[model samples]
Each structure stands twice: as structure tokens, then as C-alpha cells.
Target: MDQPTRPSKTIACLSALIKIGSSQAYALFDSGSNTDSMTPEYANAIRGPRIKLTEQVTLQLGCIGS
Candidate 1:
């Protein structure tokens, strides 16, 4: 079996309450992250214009290949 990979560095995060449209939601802010993400349910709950990506992209969370 392949061993689980470990994170190379510690990531800093902060908890915050933010407004999306007229609704407020609790969120985590990651200082080390270069990208933004949210749950599919949350995305659907908020009112906004969403842009459909022409190409799907994959991201490595925490560390590379994680």
C-alpha cells in the first residue's frame, strides 16, 4: 500500500464571517493559499453570477500533490 503524503509546511488560516450578497456565511481564510474555494452547497446558496469554466482545473491543496 502507498503511504499517505504529509504536508511540507504549516498553513495559516483564520475564521471569519463574511457576506455573500445579502447572506452571511462563516468562512476560513487561508493566508498561504493562492486560490479560492467554497462548498457546492454554499455556492448554490449564495446569489451571484457564476462563470462556467471552459476547462476544468485541478488544484493541489496544502502542499504540492496533496
Candidate 2:
């Protein structure tokens, strides 16, 4: 029997300093990512606008089950 081939991994990351509400923060940029996320504490600290979702959505992280 033949074995299935694994997909190639491509990782692209960049470190940058960004400004949020007059505050500067170090951030990592991923050009190939489909979604972006931040910690709940950081989100609250940024004091940015929040939108309530009509429905709950689940996200699947690579190598880490949701």
C-alpha cells in the first residue's frame, strides 16, 4: 500500500511595532494566516471597538484541536 504525502509547511512571520490608541505594542505579522487573534486582556487594554456576533463560531488551530 502507498502512503499519503504530507503537505509542505510554509511559515512567514515578521515582528513589528504598532500603535494602538496612542500606545505602542510589539506585534507579530503573519502574511499567510487566514485569521488574526489577540489575548482577551490585551484586547481590553487596547480599548478598541467591539462587535457582538450574531452566532458563535469555532476556530480550528493547526496541530491544536479547537
Candidate 3:
């Protein structure tokens, strides 16, 4: 079963390109989104500490023009 959809609304968001360690990345800001995502290359480039989570998460994104 699919989750109930929320009302789609257009809102202003802030996005910026910032340097993470040596590499740079585009950071997205979405107040309505339930989850955040990043590429493995970016994470590796940062070389931050890794912590194992007790639970895993699933990220679902709707395709354009469904």
C-alpha cells in the first residue's frame, strides 16, 4: 500500500554550492521533504566519521511527469 500523499505546494527554497572539505557540492533545502540524500563520492570526499545506524531508511522520489 502506498502512503497518503500530501498537498503539493510551491514554496521558496534555499540551495547553495558549498565546498565540503576539498570537493564541492550543491546543498538543497526542502522544508517539505521527509528525507535528505547525498552521493557516495561526496561523502567519501568529506571523509567524516561513520556511525552505524540501528535502523535503515528508504528514500523515495517521484518521477517527473508521472
Sort the candidates on TM-score, descending order: 1, 2, 3
Q: What TM-score would you give candidate 1 relative to the actual structure?
A: 0.61
Q: Please report, as a residue range, the 10-residue window in candidate 1 with the lowest summed lDDT.
A: 5-14
lDDT, model 3: 0.75
Query: RMSD (Cα, Å) of candidate 1?
Result: 6.6
Model 1 lDDT per residue over 11-46, tens place = 445788998888898988767778888777787877
* Candidate 1 residue runs with Cα over 4 Å from true position: 1-13, 63-66
Clashing pairs in 1: none
Instruction: Indicate the worst ten consecutive residues by lDDT in candidate 3.
Output: 4-13
Once fitted onto the true fold, the runs of candidate 2 whose alpha carbons sit more than 4 angstroms away are 1-12, 64-66
| lDDT (10s digit) by residue, model 3, range 14-57 | 89997766777889887789776677776777895566879997
lDDT of 3 at 43: 79
TM-score of each: 0.61, 0.57, 0.56
